[model samples]
Every structure is written in C-alpha cells, then in structure tokens.
Target chain A: MQFGLSDSQLLLKDNARKFFASECPMASVRRLMETGTAYDAALWSKMAEQGYLGIIFPEEYDGAGLGKVDLIVLMEEAGRALLPGPFFSTVALAGAVLSEAATPEQKKRYLAPLCRGEARATVAFLETGASWNPADVRVASANGRLSGEKLFVTDAAAADFLLVVAREGVYVVQTKAAGVSIELMNGLDLTRPQYAVRLSGTPAEQLGNSEGLARGLQVGAAALAAELVGGMQRTLEMTVEYAKTRKQFGKPIGIFQAVQHQCADMYLETESARSAAYYAAWALEENSPDAEAAVSIAKLYASDAGRTVGNRGIQVHGGMGFTWENDVHLYYRRAKASETMLGDATFHRERLARLVIDAHGALAKSA
Target chain B: MDLNLSADERSFRNEFRTWLEANVPRDWPEWREKPLEESFDYLRAWQRKLYEGGWAAVSWPREYGGRSATLMQQAIFWEEMARLEAPPMANALGLGLIGPTIIAYGTEAQKKRFVPKILSAEEIWCQGFSEPNAGSDLASLQTEARLDGGHYVVNGQKVWTSYGWIGDWCELVVRTDPNVPKHKGLTVLLLNMKSPGVEVRPLRQMTGESEFNELFFRDVRVPVDNVLGQVNDGWNVAISTLMHERGSYGARLHLLFKRNINRLIELSRTFKHNGCPAAQNPLVRQKLAQCYAEIEIMRLNQLRAFSRITATGIPGPEGSIQKLFWSELNQRVQQVAQELLGPYGQLAKGDLLAVDNGIWSYGYLRTRGNTIEAGTSEVQRNIIGHFVLGLPRSY
Candidate 1:
C-alpha cells in the first residue's frame, strides 16, 4: 500500500500550485476581497481554463472527469494561495451536489455551464437554525416554489443559481429569479463571502433525493478539510519564517524554547491535519466503506488544527501578527471561518460518535 | 496514493495470519496475567515459535533469518499480530532497535553472531545509553571505557535500562576519550550482561514493578572485537539506534492504543454517568470520538512515514512527528478513559472492582514514561525544531 501521491497526481498538484501562485497571489486575494462580492470573473474563468471548476465532473458534462482526490489536491493549492472567489462555493459545494444528484438533463443545462465558467452556483443549506444536519433543514419547497430564508449561504450573491436544500429535497433556483433576495453578510472570512438568501414563492425545480445531498455534503466537507490543511501549512511556513528572522533579545526568537515548542506543535498539527484530510479524500474517491467516518474525522481534525495553527502562528509573530496589514490574520480569519463551515469540530465529533456506536453495536450483535 | 494491498502483500498477510492462527499460544490471556518476570519463558517460547515459522523480524534482510519483507508487509505483520491478540516477543528492544543497529553498523561477524539469536530470543538485549547524569543531554554521558590490552575496561553506570536484569547482552555506549568532545569520544560495545563486575539492581517504577534497572559496571572488560562500530564513533551508531526506535514504534503503538481505545469504548457502554451509559453522555462521546480521530490520524501518519522511508531508503524527520504525536495522544487517551470510568479507574490491578483489571490505571502511570523514555517530548520537539524546521537549537 502506498500513502503518497501518484506521478500524475503529483504533477497535477505541482501545476496547480504554480497556476495559483501566478493567477491568485495573496495580493490579488486582498484586492478581490475588497470588492462588492469578492468574486473576480477573470480569476473564475482562469480557474475554469485550468479545469479546476470541473475537476471532478464527468467528461459527458464537458469536465475534466477527475476524482475526489484530484479535487482536494487543487483545493489545497487554492487554499494555500488564499484564492478569493466563488470557486469553492461553485465547484466544491454546488458542483459536487449537481454531480452527485443532478439528472443528465440537469447536468447539460446547469452543470455544463458551471464547468465552462459561464455560471456560478452555491448550496443554500442552512436556515434560521444554522445547523449542518440535513434533518435540521427548515426551508420548505411546495408546488415547485420555495418560500424560506437561508442564512449564511456561501457566495449566494455571486451565484447564478442556488441549490436550495429544502425539507422535501434539494431544489435549484436562480439567484436573479423573481421573489429572490440576496444580501451579502459581513463574514469573518473575507476571501469567501457568505450571504443571506431570502426566497418568497421563488420557482424551483427538485434536483435530487436526500441521499445524494448527504453524499455531496461529505464531499464538500472533505474538500474543505483539504483546504484547511493548506491554510494551516501556509500559516506554519509564515510563522516559522518569522520566528527564524524575528530577533528578540540577542538571537532569533526561534532559539527560545517557548517559541520553538509552539512552532513544533504547529508543525505537528499541520502535518496531522494533512494526513487526515488526504486520507479522507482518498477514502471518498475510492468509495471505501469508511468514507463517511473518514470525512467526519478529516473535518473534525482539520477544523481544530486550522484554528490551533492559526492561534500559534499569531502567537509566535507577537504584536506584528495582530496587525491588519499582516497576511497572518488573513489565514487566521480563513481558518476560523472554515472551522465552522461544513459542520464544526463538535458537530463532526458527535456524528463520528454515532457511527462508532452503531458499528460496535453491529459487531456485538454479530458476535 | 494507493492504500490497497498488492497481491503479494495480501498473500503475505494471509500466510502470516494462517501461521499465527495455528501457532499463537492459546493461553496468552492467562500468560499475560503473570508478572513480567514470570512470563519471560512463555514470551521466549513465543518468539522461538515465531522464529521457527520464519515470522520473526519480517523486515530484516533474508541473510539475517528474515523474509526480507517489504515495509507494507512489516506493517501488515503488526496489524495481524494485534488483530489476533498475539503475545509480544521476549526481545522487543532487540528486534526493534539493537538488531537494526547491528544490521546497519555491525561487522560481518557481529551480524552473524548476534542477529539470529536476537530473533530467536536467545540473547535478549537492552540499550545502555542513558546515564544518571545524562537523560536529555545523552551525548554528555560520562560512562567511560578505556582500551587496555585489546579489551575495553568499562567502569560506569547506566540507569533506566529496561530489561536490565533479564537481558543477556547490552548495547552499551561509553566514553572512550576524555580529551575530545562529549559526542565524539564515545564508543558502542556489545557487552555480555554476564561479564565480571557487572551489577544490575532493580529500579521500581511508579507502576510498582521493577521492569527496568540501574546497571553498575565496575571495571567490566569487553573484548575490542565486541565494538559494534569504529572506535570513537559511537555517537552516530547510538543515534542510529534511537532513529530505529522512533522509526517503527508508531506501528506497534497503534495496535496497542487501538486495544486501549476499544476497551475504553466498551467501558463507556457499561459505565454510567448522569444516570445513563457514559457513551450516551454528549461530553463523553465527544471525548471518545476525538480520541478515535487522533488514533486514526496516528495510523495514517505512520503510513505516511513508511511511504517516505520506502521511497527514500532511510527514515526521515517525519519519524519525530509520529513520536511526538503518539506519545501525547496516548496520554490523552488515558485521560479520557479516567474521565469515562470515574473513580473506578483509579483502582489497582489486584483490587476486586478495578476496571479492565486496572490496566488503565497502570497505563495512566506507565505512559508518563512514554513521553520521557525513548526521548522526552521536549527532546522530540527540539529535534523537530532543529532537524525538521531548521530552527536554531534551543541549547
């Protein structure tokens, strides 16, 4: 058994890193975050040209026809660059949902344009309750019409369509459709803007069943976990660099054990998160029996590690880390936002607990 | 990226599993209940059985009485062993650390003489690196050995030597020259434990057992031929031993921690908290689930390390990452056990109501040494800081 990237996967990862480095540097990230929707059309088209927007979509849909591992590899690179846009919402969230649930006709009409960068889409899953559990969904769709408020809907303002998760099933609704209201919320993560979407009798079409939506959420969680790993890695590099150069009394502050041990912890957490996230992606790609538990494990571990690495990163940088001018805060903000996005640590841990309990119960019964 | 076992590996696993199912001592659970000293013979016989089946030291080279198995096979070996709840071999230090060091640095005669016996558990081994004065700063050890008439006259003490009393030989590191740097003046010798003037005094650990000892060497003479490597170059040899310790310990620990966690989960199902099973408590479930994730991460991290070694032909600094993680993760796992079991967890092994025969209690105390032994977590961090991150050494 090999636990590393294959030659092609490595090449894809390297090319993606180089592509993001040139196309979506932190400077561009900052420039775009200041915009109204934090969505750059040119960057979105460039990503589509790279086939990232359709990395996991099938060839029939004019896509790259890659797998989940490939998607995470590209997502990790985008995360490292702090790529600001509707990419994650469009590709990782909405694209995954459509790929998992959409009919062939739906794929041709909706997923194909998303693959070609002609449209943007995102999932509107959370409502007033703000819970990730599909069972907690309160949005109602009746008579092919949606009438509910979806809070913290990622990139809804920038999306051409919204995959609104309703009590009946997932529904597709146009963002600019009559009776649709989208207001961009002040989000902690500047790079990925969230919005409140209000639907009053908006015409919607049911996309797929609850089973497909659940599968899509798992894919999204694993992808976000990979993204968090990238953010943690970059934060670690920045912190370690600052520690080596930033002198305190007589030597570099890194020479101090207090600083060095914390840096070690950061390195440990970042590497561990990478392991968990990559394994989750591989598990999902393989459709392994452990895929559900692996996804929760990845999301749970990365959610905590992302915040911790950010905390330690800022701590090691001392006062400079606190400045709005420093890029460290940007990663810190992203980590904080991502921590709670696709089910926070507490949420996933509880989910894992149930899975473990059921498996053990099954074992006991068999025995 | 492929974690699926190849056909060869799968066949190897099946072969080993069959052998183990047939040969594993059916009385291991009772044998494990015996004191450490009383179980040596049983463990030795187990190791011999493994040796006879050619299952001992699967990762060692073919010439050294091993299958010359791939790293994945070695991992599979450990996994199957844990799965069957097989008894541990008598010569853990030997198989894990000393034999590998000998394979790397020992002379042709040395490998021929020592390697097979280690696998057969004929000559159990213990490392003699840490002195009373040299715990973290191990290179500063002052255990001196002077060359005299083709023999090294050793006169120093080694502390915290595991299996010191039972070991047939010692992989001893000693200072050969006082005029040079502490690190440069060292030499490693394969000293027979039965040598004249050598004394082993049992040191009781916090667990109320003398599983280790303080070894006193009063002018113990070692033949010059017994030196494992070149004179005054024992630092690198000893470092190789420590590297071997960190390199593969995670796979072993994974099975062990897995057992403990499984036991904890079972206990959580029975133990009551707030008028319900502890497993029903949200806080307990969260803790258990977190520990579960951490343990899984530990396994994945080990695989990552193994993948790197398989590619590079040498263990990388990532071993330090595994070392740092599992040591602390085990501690957290134990703490969660105590939290779930409550007051019953504090009972000793002989106590009537002790949980899991007080294994958790013993583990809680014994694992305090995990981070301290092999290398302290602080020492590991220092290594990661200097080696992995290229930071300036704190010292």
Candidate 2:
C-alpha cells in the first residue's frame, strides 16, 4: 500500500499554501467570519479561474482532474483563511454528488458549471442534529415537486441551487423556484453559514434515485472528510506557530512542557486526520469495491479530528483564541461548523459499525 | 513522493512474510511463559530463523551477518509481523537500544561477543537505565559503578526494568564519577542479571501483570570487558541507543492492538440485546466510527515514520511522535471499547455473562501498562515539540 503522499499531492499542497498565504488576507478572514457570508465573490472567482473548484472532477468537465489529495490542499489553505460560505459544501459536496451519482446527462449539465464555479450549489442532506443517515432526510419528494423541510442546510440561503436529499430521491431544485424558502439560522461560528429549507411543492429535477443519492452522499461525506483533514492540519500548524511566537511567564509558551505536549498532541491529531482524509481523497481515483468503506472511515476521522484540533487550536492560542479578531478562533469555528455540516462524527461511526458487520459476514460466507 | 515499495522491496517483504509463516512456532499460546523469558525465546528463535534465512541483523555490517536491509524493508518487516500476529521479541533492550549502542562504540571484541549473542538471543537482557529518582531526567541516575583496578564495583538500584526477573543480563547505567554534570560521569554496563547481589523484584501494575521490575544490585562486580564504551563516557553511548530506539535499524516492537480494534467491531455486532444486534445501536455505531478514526490516525502517524525511513534510512527524534501516538491510541481504543460496553462493561469474564464476553475489560487491563512503557507519553510529547518542531525545551 502507498503510505505517503504522491509528488503531485505534495506539489498541490504547497501551491495552495503559497496562494492562500499571498491572496487570502487574515483581515479578510476576520471580516468573512464576522459577516457570515460565503467567501468574497472576487476571490471565489479567482479560485475558479485558478481551476481549483473543480479540482476533484474530470478535466473534460472543466475540473483540474486532480485526486482527493489535491482538493484537500485547497481545503486546508481555505481553512487557514477561515473563508466563509460553501466552498466545501458546494464544490466538495454538490460537485461531488454530481460527479459521483448524477447520470451522464445530469453531469453534462450541472457538473461543468460547478467545476468552473459558474454556479454554486448547496446540499440539503442533514435534516436535524447533523446526522448522515439516508433515513434522516425529512424532506420528501412527490410528483417532481420536492416538499418538506431540510434543517442545517449549509450555505442554503446563498446558493443558487439546492441538491436536496429526500425520500423520493436526490433532486436539484432552484432556491428561488416556486414554494422554495430559506431561513438563516444562528450558528456559533459565523465563518460557515447555515439555513433551514422548506420545500413546499418546489419544482425539481431528479438527478439520482435513493441508491444514487446514497452513493452521492457517500462522495460528499468523503470529500468533506478530506476538507476537514486539511483544515485540521493547517489549523494545528498555525496554532503551533502561534505558540512559538506568543510569550508567557517571561518565555515563549511553547517552552513549557505543558504547552509543548499540547502542541505535540495537536500534531498527532492533525496527522491522524490527514491519513483518513488522504485515503478518502484517493477513493476518487477509482471507485473500487473498497471505496465506500474507506470513505466512511475517513469521514469518521476528519469530522472528529477537525473538531478536536479546532478546539485545541483555540486552546493553544490562549486568550487571543477566544477573541473575535484572531485567526485561531476562525479555525475553531470552522472545525465546529464542519462537524455538523456533513454528518457529525457520531453518524459515520455507526455507519462504520454496520459496514464492519456486513464485511465480516461476507468474509464468513467466503471462508 | 508516491509510497510504492520497489519491486525488490516487495519481494523482500513477500519473502519475510513467507518465512515468518513457515517458522512461527505452532504453539503461540505458550510462546512467552514469562514476559521476559518468552520474549527472549521467541525473539531468539525468530532471530535465528532470520539469521539462517540470511535476514537477521538488518543494520549490521556485512561481516557481522546482517542483511543491511533498507529502512523501509525493516519497517515493512515489522508491519508484516504485526499483520501476522507474531509473539513479541525478547531481546529488545540489547537489540533495539544497547546492542546498537555497543555497535556504535564497542571495541571489536565487544561487538563480536555481544552483537551475535544478541541476535541469537543467547542472553536475554533488560534495561537498567531508569532509576527510582531519575526517569525523565535520566542523566540523574545514581546506580553507582566505581572502577576498581580492572573491574567496576557497582552498587545501587535500577527500577522499572522490564522482564528483569527473566532476563539473563541487564544493560545498565551507573555513576562512574560524581564530580561532573548529571549527564557526565555515567557509564553503560552490560551486567549479568544472575551476578551476585542482583535482585529483581516484580512490581505489579494496575494491569495486574508485572511487565517490569525494580532491580537492585548490591556491590556487583562487572569486568572491564563489560564496559560498552569508555569509562565514565556512556552518556554518548546511551544517546545512540536512544537514537536507535527511534530508527528502524533497531529491533521490532509488536504493536498488536490495532487488530483488537478490528476484532472489537466484529464482536460488537454479534452481541445482541432485546432482539437486535448491538451494532444497530446508534451509540455503538458512533463509537465504532470514532474507533475507525483513531485507527486511521494511528496508521497515519506510523505512515509518517515510514515516510521518513523511506527517504533518510533513519528515524529521527521525530520517531518519538509515532511512539507517543501509538501508545496513546492503544490506550484510548481500549478505553473506548469499555465505555461502549455500557454498564455491562464492568463485569469481567465468568462474572454472570460479561459484556461482549468481557473482551473490553480484558483489553482495558492489558493496555493499562502501555502509557508507562517504552517512554511515558508526557516525555515523548516534550521531545517532539522541542526537538522536532523546534519549540523551546521546557522542564
């Protein structure tokens, strides 16, 4: 098994880090976190222009045709910026859903625009409490008009379209279409926006059926895991740097064994997150029989690790971490928000348990 | 770079796998009766098999019967062994730490006598480094070994000696002179455990198993030939042992807990209550998910170590990072397994139907000593943050 990053993965990561350090200002991150807006439109366009939004999609579809690792690099830098809105939800989720489950016709229509960032869409999968069970979808579908409410829909209010998961199937519905409604919800962290979606007879085009939706959700969940892995790594890296520069008790806090140990643990945490994220990213390379299990495992790791490193980042930064202005707090907020966005850590854990059982049974039969 | 093992390496790994399978004694249930003795026997047997197969002494010179295998191959061998569920090695003290130190600084006679014996497992060994007062500040060890004529009259105590009771020999650190800094005036001694006045008292731990013992040496005699390096200059020798401990050039430690996590998920499914499998519970699902996450992370940390070895042929102080994470993950996984058992977790085997066959409690007890072994997690983290990450050193 390949145990480390490929050269392209490393290059992609370095390039994203260079770009973010240059283009995405800390002040801009602070502003976005305060405003609860999606990323700056101009910068969003810049990412699109750089061919980053379509990183995990096909080159024919206007994507960079990169692996999960490549997009992961972008996600990490984006986390460093604490850029608000739906870069992850739309590009990572909506785009992934289209790439994975959409029919060829659907992909030709929606995938191209999404890859190019000409259109940004959000996923309405989590009905409540940030869980990712197909059964969790309260929003129902009937007569090509999807109705019911989707809760905690990340970036729902701002997106031009909604990729809704419902009992009837997975459908694409315009946010401004008939009977479509969105209400912004209060979130602990403002960097990522959330919404409550009420789809009352909203005109919709079905993209994938339940199975298709399940596959698509798997893709989205995995991509989100990859993103969180990146986020946790950069967040920890930034916090460690902050620990070195910040002084306490007449010495840099990093000198204290307590601080050093905490930073070391963060390093371990980030590394752990990276492994799962990278493996999930690699799943996009080939949708083999093992892909689903790999993705489930990865998502489980990233969501939990993202939250931990996020909280730890703030802790390592001390008082400034609690402040509204510091970048550390921004990452902490992203970690918290990312957890609930694409099925919290607990949801994937249960899915993993089921998969393990099923896998064991299969092995038993074969034996 | 991509992490593909080369064709040659792949073949090497396949050969190792085949060899282990063929050679692993059929009776693993009785392999290591005494933690120390069993480790020694199994390791010696394994080492002999490797030696006969021309695979032993991975990092030694060609003349010394070593393969000089690539660091990645060594890592692959360890991983493969873990995958195969082999018994633990016995001569780690000599092979991983002290033997490496001897090779680095020992005279030709010293190397000839010790290295081959260590590989053949002729003499089981334990570390006499950490003392009652000196652990993290290891240089402060007070086990005095005074040079008398051509021999050293050693007297004092070395604690936490893993398998000392079963060990035939001990790799010791003793104060040769008290006039210098704590780090200075210390000498490394390869002393026979059965030597006069040597005592090994088992100290039972929270796990109910005594993995290590408190070793006391009251005026034991060590020959001049037993000195690993120069008199009163062992701090440097000890440093190399620590380095070898981090690098792949050393002996292998069987980290078998990852398998436990996999097996646990399976057992949880079979454990049904109220006409439903325990796996159906959302809480069970979540804990499994979290365990999956822990396993992935643990694997990643190991991957980092593997990556460094792939390029540099050496594991730096950064090796401490992997060691720390693995230990912590082992502890956490065991902890979670019990926590997931709910109230039934409290019952052990043969206690009115233990939860999930009492697997969680068994695991929890076995891993209790993990945090203290190799090196404490606290000590490891400090090393990583400072030595590797370039943070300032704190006490």
Report the poorest 10 consecutive residues by lDDT, candidate 1 chain A: A358-367
> How many backbone clashes can be found in candidate 2?
8
lDDT of 1 at B294: 97
Interface RMSD of each: 1.6, 3.0
Please write out the lDDT profile of model 2 over residues B1-395, one tens digit for every residue.
34456898899888888888887666665543444544555667776776677665565666766666765667777777777766655576766677677777889998888788777777777888888898878999888987788889999988888768778878788999899988889999889888898988997877566778999888899998998888788898887777666554222432455566666676666766466776666766676657666665555556666665666656577567666766666777877677556677667765777864565776677666666665677888888888777898786
Clashing pairs in 1: A4-B1
TM-score of each candidate? 0.99, 0.88
Leading candidate by lDDT: 1
Provide the TM-score of chain A alone for each candidate, in the order shown. Answer: 0.97, 0.91
What C-alpha lDDT does candidate 2 achieve relative to the native structure? 0.73
Name every residue pair that clashes in candidate 2. A38-A85, A272-B297, A349-B285, A349-B289, A350-B285, B32-B38, B39-B90, B40-B90
The DockQ assigned to candidate 2 is 0.47
**Which window of ten consecutive residues has the lowest lDDT sum in model 2 chain B?**
B246-255
Q: How many residue pairs clash per model?
A: 1, 8
